[model samples]
Target: MESEINKSPKASAFTLIVAFVCVALVGLALVPLLPVKLNPSRTLPGFTVRFSMPGTSARVVEMTATSKLEAMLARVKGIRGIYSTSGNGWGSISVNLDKHVDAAVARFEASTIIRQTWPELPDGVSYPYIQMQSPGQGSQSPFMTFTINAPATPVLIQRYAEEHIKTRLAQLSGIYKINLSGATPMEWRLEYDSEQLRTLGISTDDIREAVRLHYQKEFMGTYDVEQGASDRQWIRLALVPESESRDFDAGRIQVKMKDGRMIGLNELVKVSRVEEQPQSYYRINGLNSVYLSVVAEETANQLALSKEVKAYMDGIRSQLPAGYEIHTGYDATEFIREELNRIYLRTGVTVAILLLFVLLITFSPEYLFLIVVSLSVNIAIAVIFYYAFGLEMQLYSLAGITVSLNLVIDNTIVMSDHYLRCGNRKVFMSVLAATLTTIGALVIIFFLDEKIRLNLQDFAAVVIINLGVSLLVALFFVPSLIDKIGLERRKRISPSKPKLKL
Candidate 1:
């Protein structure tokens, strides 16, 4: 095998050049297409369940929603822990699953149990809202956030976002969730006059019961009636408006008066459309603002999504109302990009310092040049294999590359030093043994369970590939290149003793 490997660089150097060219082309092409992310996903498999019980105390919320939901979800397979929070009129439960659980399967199982448990909930409890927090995105911040600052009222800004901005941005491919802060919910407000109510002998409960019975809209149920000889027709019942406004059926609604006469709702109460009581307020730079928080899909490119959002904002700038401006805030993509740039800068500085030290010890520019070339080719090959192995270019993989660079430089120096002292055979054998030892340790990491493997596999792949490539370069390419450059070991002359004529 050694003889066969030796003949390639000597007998046919062009073959090596051709091979290098092919790899270089493939490496450059794959780099751009490689999926880049900030970091590896560390979030365990889990999901969140939320519900609201309006006008209920925290203890009531816990009993009605949080505790029941937690009990139901605790039966799911691979559940690790159950956490619940109950606040005034709101309850939430978070179920953390064991790492061995498949995320998709866990979601399905959890949903099934939650749906089965829904009917058992107490009256006035809201339908459970299930949000699937992806294993990869559980800890992610919003990819981009935009604050709508307008000279108009917060209500107007919120209306603009809800009616105009939310739907448009949701249509973008990468955007999944858009949260609006400081936007009041649209609701119908009914104001009752106490004196008028007392004069009419009517109570608020009586009016509420009347509205609940006759004024609201619903698909009460479907009725099947015989339409013809054998066929049946289904009819759906829905409340239709008899008044100009669709708020309620004011005409059909009648409440029994104390005198036994039928009275209409128009006489006892005033109805108007208004914003619901706000639970929270938001302000940006001392001005009332409506904030639109945009989150990208799990596998989506954050930087690309951010750019698209910015472009969309630019296109709609002119359409915004006068004195209104969209201020960008907390762009996470830009932050990740900066972090990556810093990592790159640090890697370059590290390489330069290492090379300087190697140059001082070797005292040969030729050796330095060979080491640099070997380092470059070793990394390029590692990148090529990284794509081949179907790993992404995330922060973890980049970190692996940085570490591999140091290892490659170290191996190259070892080979060069040995070659100068003892010849090519010693260089090949020593480097091969070192590379095997390192790869053996990394291979052991692959045997770990799925939970551990997901985080480490890409990193291990990168280092192993780099070390393998370094070994090959040390054995073949470096030897051929140094010989071609006519670099040889210089002879050292011992100090000559003074010749004294006795």
Candidate 2:
């Protein structure tokens, strides 16, 4: 077998090298397509449903909205426990699902149940809103926050952010939610003077009725109009003309007094457009501002998503008015990017040190070259598997690849040493057996508890793939290439010269 392999060394070496090169090229092509995440994808085991009733006390909210929702949601399959909290004007119900339950199915059932029970809730209670508990939901922060500063009012800034920035960001894929803070809505304030109202014999209710009538449009039936000949048509009639309804004039509204006298509404009440007090406050550089918080989807690639968002913000900045500015308050992706870069730097340093050590010990550039080729081919094969198995390029998996580099070096050393000495099929069999044993040990990880298994699965997979590919490279490609280049023969002959001279 050794003689036959040596006879066609050029052919064998060329074929194997081309095959490995193709594999490397394909793997490099797929590297960019694999998702980059901080951790593996895992479904969270629960979800929350929130409802609100403005101006209602906590006790009333519990009795009316919280209790009813908990009872109705309890019927959902695979529910492990139902927890609830009721506060002033609001309540929330948390449904914890069993580990084996499908989260999607549970969410669908819960939504359907909430809609069915909507009519049973109190009159003022809001429709129950449901949100799935994504991974890290408890401690997840917004990936990006931006403060908008403008010379205009808060209401105007809020409107611009909503209509332009928020709308466009929401349309982007992988954006889970966008929240606006320091948002003040435009409101019409009606100030009434108590003494003036008393003197005019007009009450607040009278003013309210007059204002309502001023904006209200009533359909007062239709008028039968005679057209050409005997043909007749019905014309729709409205209490307020279209022209008058388009513009609001408080002076045109008249309120009836206690003495049956009509007075202008402006005489007793002042109507003015004003900004409502903001629910939340945001400040940048000690100046009041409106800010937006952008949350990423559960499975989104944070680094990629952040890049897209920054590009979008750049475009928005160019179009903003002179006095408007967008300032980034926080960028969470920066940390992730730095962390990944650190890992990459560590991997590169490890490879460099290993190569240096190999060159020092062996003093054989040929052997060092073999080790490099083996490492590269194994890594390429592992990358292909990562893409095929839906593994992410994260901390754990990168650590696995880094550790596997040492294993690749070890396997290459053993194979190269044995091939130079024995050069037989036994070299392949022994290395194959050792590699299989290592894989067997790692396979037990899959049977462990779910939480542990999910965390370590990617790491184990990366190591195992590298080990298997390394074995194939060591057994077939390494020995054939050694024969092709006459490295083995040169080493043996060189050592024999000293013995012959003695």
Candidate 3:
């Protein structure tokens, strides 16, 4: 009755019960919404910008496409960092946020930035593009491509990989972006009539100059100016502007003579379009083969996605060219999942150590009930954070959760130990007041210290919630149960009083 009377004045008793129930419901309801992605970090939306310029080497790409894209992208808001890479005929740019940003918003922002800045960029650059989705989901590479070269007809091998194998693999789940490298067919060529060229005294170098002059852009140098701390420069180039870059006329090109006479290039050589050299070169199992890589949708589960991809690959082996097969494979999902699992294992070990230490010090299993309740409180609250933040159980958040368990248990130990030390009802009231006071004093430490608050926010929050729960559990629930029911049955050790020949 005394406990009931004390509890009536404090609304915490009822509020705590209501909070626990509501939070429990929230936590349970959110389970279905958690993304099943193999890499939890991959679910956060992002966009990749890609550009390619044929005949332009890597260094040229750095100066032309990468520079222009980077300069223009600098102004976009919410950008955490800009990453750029350039290779022969290709350049890729990635902008990422430290925190999860809305994917649609990031894509739209990135696309608009690329689009508006295109005209100011150097020529020969293909239109900038943003990847609509990432390929190869879960823990496996979505595509594994090995090339088979038969000296007989490499073209047939390439055509088979494309018309049959690629088409088939595209149908698999979480698989997209199937790229085939080093498979272009050999080109048929027509050499210029050197005898006719000699009759006209036209040199081969002149023929090459004529061919290049009609098609390619020639870069001019940059103009530099001094700024307060740096020098700025703008490069200039004359281009066969978009509309004229496709000009492929054979009649207008010339073969120049030593005597200054000229003859049309078409008159000396039969000009026709044939296949160009293969763009990519690859080998597998000591045999000539093309490379194929498959990527997956970012939101897909890595483990499940990899599993499905492997299953499809195994099933489709018979469909591949007899001599051709998947030679190499790699999966990002598997690596990330393994890392998350490690974090989880560490979390379990840390919690176990904390529980054992608390139980040992108390020398009472009943006291452990508080620690159990505290850990549960944290788990329940972690679910709330998961929903509020859309935090996938990423390795980073897992680390936070592990630290939080210790905090929740720590706070409970402080509160319950105080309750245990109280000798009388007045002492109980004093100890309870003291417990709340000590909590208040220590609570500020979680927030007041930046490192502690940031690194341990999860643990701190769990402790906070658990602390509140522990108090209410003690003041109302524990007290009511203890008073109305009775003290826990204690093990009877043989009376110590002069144990006479017992």
Index of the highest-TM-score prediction: 1
lDDT of every model, 2 decimals: 0.70, 0.73, 0.55
Please give the lDDT score at residue 145 for candidate 1: 89
lDDT of 3 by residue, 305-405 (tens): 66766676677676665666664455655666777788778877887787888778757666666557545654665576565744444444555466546
The residue-by-residue lDDT of candidate 1 on 1-502, one tens digit each, is 6665435345454466456646766777667545556666546678887776767999988876788889889888988788999999888888878777887898778767866786587755655656565555624557688889876678888878877888788888877688887766554445556667778787654664565467332212111111433442211111222212445445567877778787998766555655555767777767678888987665566777778888988877778878778988778778679878988998989999998998788687877787787777767766677777667667777778888888888887787666555444455766788789989999987899656776887888888888988887777666656555424442222234589999
Which structure is stronger by TM-score: 1 or 2? 1
Clashing pairs in 1: none
User: Candidate 2 residues 346-461, lDDT tens each?
Assistant: 98898889899988987878777877877787788778888888776677887888888888888888887777765554566667778889889999998886667867888899
lDDT: which is higher, 1 or 3?
Answer: 1
For every model shown, the clashing-pair count is 0, 0, 17
lDDT of 2: 0.73
Model 2 lowest lDDT segment of ten: 217-226
